[model samples]
Target: MYSLATGFRIPVLQYGLSPTESLLTKINGGALAAAIAAAALSPPPAAWPFGVVGAGAALLNAAPGPRSIARWGAVGYRRLREHTAPASMTAARGETVTWELYPDHGTMQNPAKRASFHAAVDQALRFVSDQARTAGIQVHVTHHAITGDYTTHTQTVSVHIPKGLVASPARVLETLEDEFAGLGALMRVEPEPIPTVTEQGSGWVALDDDRYASTARITGWPPRDDGTLIRKFLLGDERPPRDAARDVVPERSMAVLYRPLTQRRSRWLTRIQEAANGAFTTDPIEKEKIAIESDGRHDAMVAGEVLVDVDAYITVWGHNPDSVSAARWTMTRLADRHRIRLDWLAGQQHRAHVMTSAHAVSTRKGSVL
Candidate 1:
């Protein structure tokens, strides 16, 4: 986790393994345990083969490259099985309310205007979060940006209230709609259902038809600086001269999910974290860094700013795999330039693809990948 001056932590997103990998890990552990038991019950020679087999499997699974290969293989096998029976298609569950935010075209082109618009959006989200907390519920706010030509973008913010969490979901939507409209941006509610993903591959998924997309999760952030990290990341360098032979501008979408912590909870957690750091830290340089971070958190809390857990996903789209892969490479290069790290959803691209939409609820709780 990285601390930002804006009182947000980068990469608060939890890491989880795919089901196949997870099952393999458990089996490996059990095999190792059985090997130990066999050795204890018998002599060395009798258990030598068991131990060797268990150790070899464990090592193969533990290594990064091999593990990734195994995961990809597992997904490929599953895809083949699915292809035999096309009716067993999977779909995301639950309903979501999405509000599209259309800011003036100049808001994205002008740096100052973009910054100001972002601040307003943040304030509006914070207000809605506070209200949701009072109502004893958690609301997922997902900001989505979709562009076809890389010139025109459609941005939307979606709110998802978990079922049975509140008495009246419609009332919550009303409050959110009102607060977001105050930003002076054109807002509209989308009535269409979430798009169904038709096909899945190693690193990409086909949405509905003709649209192939690859999704990646932001894993690491650049060093602390002014809170313009996201701005610089989204508004990359100017487009290069277009060449038909080299340029493939694939349709793309970026989604940022925000889940805010209540003021009381944020303060309590920060205090505990500070105490743990101060008590355990020994290196002088690292201790100084922690102290500075603690102070920044303190100041931000005092200023009445809410601390939020944020996770972001980007999806690059095309009509074919090759073009999508090309666009994904471009995105990877841009991320590297900003000192950001991305984990392309190798085996779970379908799920990550759904996450790039406003209708999909944020993964606040653990779910199968």
Candidate 2:
């Protein structure tokens, strides 16, 4: 009976269903149906309410017909399964996965070298795109801005791969590496792994192999004409005054997931007008908001450019719980200095993994074109 119930429900359930419940439904449905039918036909027990039992069974079924209870039970179970599904499973259902590409060189600050490096990156991207298309694998590449400062301006590129065409996320990465090698882009590339549920805790779960990552989701400061705050942060500029006794640098990684904004006449006009009012407002905080918006608006207005939505994350890694705890404190302090807010990715274990996950874990997270 459970098999029959599951067979009936499988065609209707769009997502996935559990085998345990299906088996239980098959076992119980026959017995329940028989009991109900037998009760209805038997002489009424003085204390038993036949109408109530029939109505209760009907309500339990929720659907029409004799087998409604069994079918409805399967439907209910499916709903529960979806709500309790693992976050990783939800993420994997997508057509594509995001991978982060990095270069071997420490800082590409020299103009001639930077330009050469960028050129190679462009050539490699174009080559990969063309190759993926020929192979019928759809992909989109996002070019991240590399900051020039007294720090390592690591080249970061986000690659999106359709899971259907590619058997695994690792394959997409292998293809990129091969393309880069072919183009003579002598940089070493590392692909981020998919966040997997390695362990379940009280209220959260661990991700990736390293169970010691201190992660956070940063709400970035508004757009400004001089966006050096974010630029410097990404460039790994560590010039901020710190208490040497308390502040310490640890194994860390940062990711900035952003998209450029395009000019739209109506929206542009509205923002400009808002900034104008903001300029006139007496409140200091309001004025600051206006300044940020105005600067961004003015910057965008120049030659009619686009704005960018930047989502930044900083991860600190350690060898043990104590080290992770200390590194997280330092990372948080640095974030505070930059006027950015950090909300921990909670249960995320690897800084590198979190950084890569940021690249592709959003709806329209990357520029499709």
Candidate 3:
């Protein structure tokens, strides 16, 4: 587990080993232990070869190496067979409300306007957190931005409320629509149909013939500061000189999913973390850092701020594989400059692509890879 500067601890990767990988790891460990025991009980020249083999296997299976090979091979074989007949995905249930926000001109440029806009967003998210806590259900709020032709851009917010979670999901959506309108922005509710993914590749998925998209999750974010890090990452440097032609912008869609934790759960976790901080660390500097984070968390909790878990994924689209690869490279370079880390969805491209849509939140229990 890694703790962010915000004092939230999230797993490095929300996934664990597949069954095949676990089986192989167990077999290798057993063989190594048996060989070592035999050599200790009776020293023999013949036992040395078995020990060597076992040791080699163990070494190969060490951190981030051959241990994942079995899983990779299995996924690769399955994908190979899928090439003959591409796999498709459709929504299991629920509807989504997607609305575009058209803010006043220069809203982001003026500091006062930007602050007001941000405050409205924060209030809206807090309402969502409250609803999730009261209903005991997960609510997904996805902020999606798209640059289709690289000349014009659209920013839309999608809210998904699973069926049976509340008395009326439509009422919840209507409330959100009113919230955005209070931001002094034009809110155009766009009803989107359930998207159907037609084909999937190793790292890319096809929504149709013209759009081949590759999705990557943001794994690491720069330290918390005045929010400049995200601004620079999502929106590039200020506009180019009037005389200079603008750089080529790749067609892409970025979606960020925010899920707020319940008040009770957040408080419980914060208390546990506060107790565990200095108890486990001895270094003075490390202790100080943890102390600061603990104080921050406590202050926020006292101030009626809700803690949220955030997941961001970007999908770059193109007409062909080569074009998609090029856009992906550009996206990687941009993330690197901002000190953000991205994990491109390799074997689970189809699932990752579905997450980018405005469909229902995944109810599947277990690790979310």
Candidate 4:
């Protein structure tokens, strides 16, 4: 018997009924049905940032197509499956899986494998949202996919801050780092200490805007405008210095010191200075053209504008592959003839280089966009 109000569809108990269904059976039914109904009526939350615009650093690197967003989700999800599947029901969060089946299925080796990984990310977000919703926390998550081994090399990140529950990159990252009891890959959460934006007054919505949906610039870590969280929400001294993430970054790893438009040049300059002590020449380019192919559902030029202030980035995605790089190179050379910067670098290339997963990868940096 199912109560329309409760959605609790209690299948009439099997076996011989005791003197026909009594008041006990009628009073309680479909408890789970009701909760599922409520969730169905609620809007879907943002799973991750809407997209990574290749804004600054993301622009300078990440190409030849590394992993897709779905691929990244696969990585995180695979680890979750392995860690939680074998645990007891009490230890498992909200998952209904028979934890033992994880290993039995031989799915551990390919955690980031497309099919299973995407499903895992979906389930993880659902569980997190359900738990938080019951506790009065609302979340927004968006998913994006990119190119790669379509397996182990993908990154799930966002600059967009979810409304209601304002958590910083550090906090969210802490949960990520400690998640699965650190059984997964070692993840580093680097929050650049710069004035960033949030959707505080904007409130949550079914669909997000272009600018705010690009990347996660601000988070709840440093605290709201009133200057809290440093001592109270977070324990430490007042007036913590910027570059806190810089200090904590893993030694000799390629990372983008992410920030808004104004800070890219400065950060790039610094990176150039530091890299000078080693190999890789960081020279100033003049009037160069760059070609960007983002797996983003929508290709916005906001990042191009940011780069245009210092260099030119042509949004060349659909052109024939054979001539695309050559065309960009020709443009850079022409610009150089007029004494303009000739360095044409594709941002995606750098991202691919940094995120190289157990492989020595070649890049297309010198190919002129």
Q: Which is the leading candidate under TM-score? A: 3
Tens-digit lDDT track for model 3 on 1-369?
A: 122222123221112333344465567667667777877887763566576665545333433522233345554665555432222333335546666666777666677887888788777767776765442333344444445445455666767665666677777778878988866564556546544557766577776545788888777787754645555555566656771233233576666655565667667767766666656678999889888877887888787677666666777777877878887888888887678888895666755665555542433211124
Ranking by TM-score: 3, 1, 2, 4
Q: What TM-score does model 4 achieve against the real structure?
A: 0.19
TM-score of 2: 0.45
For residues 254-313, write the lDDT of model 2, one tens digit per residue. 665433322353245446556556545789887777677667656545633433334455
Q: Better model by lDDT, 3 or 4?
A: 3
The candidate, 1 or 3, that scores higher on TM-score is: 3
Ranking by lDDT: 1, 3, 2, 4
Show how many residue pairs clash in every candidate, following the order shown: 0, 5, 0, 34
Per-residue lDDT tens digits of candidate 1, residues 1-369? 222221112122112343444565567667667877877887664756676765645443433542334454655565555432122122323335666776666565677876776677666556645654432233433443444455555667777665665567788778777766755564666635445667766678777757888888776777664556665555544455673324334466777666666677667767777777777678999999989878888888887776665667777888887878888887887788778878785556755666666644434422212
lDDT of 3 at 195: 41
Using TM-score as the measure, name the better of candidate 1 and candidate 2: 1
Residues 1-369, model 4: lDDT tens digits: 000111111223211112212332333334334444555687572322222212222222222233223233433454344321121211212211101011113233343443354344333333333322222121211111222233122222222222333344335424433332223333333322222222211111011221111111111121122322211211112334683322221111111111122224423433443333233323334112111122120132232221111111211111233333333343333333333332222222222211211111111111111
Tell me the spans in candidate 4 whose CA falls farther than 4 Å from its real position.
1-116, 131-154, 158-173, 176-184, 189-369
Greater lDDT among 1 and 4 belongs to 1
* RMSD for each of the candidates: 7.2, 16.3, 7.5, 28.1
Clashing residue pairs, backbone N/CA/C < 3 A, model 1: none
- How far is 309's C-alpha from truth in model 3 (Å)? 1.2
State the C-alpha lDDT per candidate.
0.60, 0.45, 0.59, 0.24
TM-score of 3: 0.70
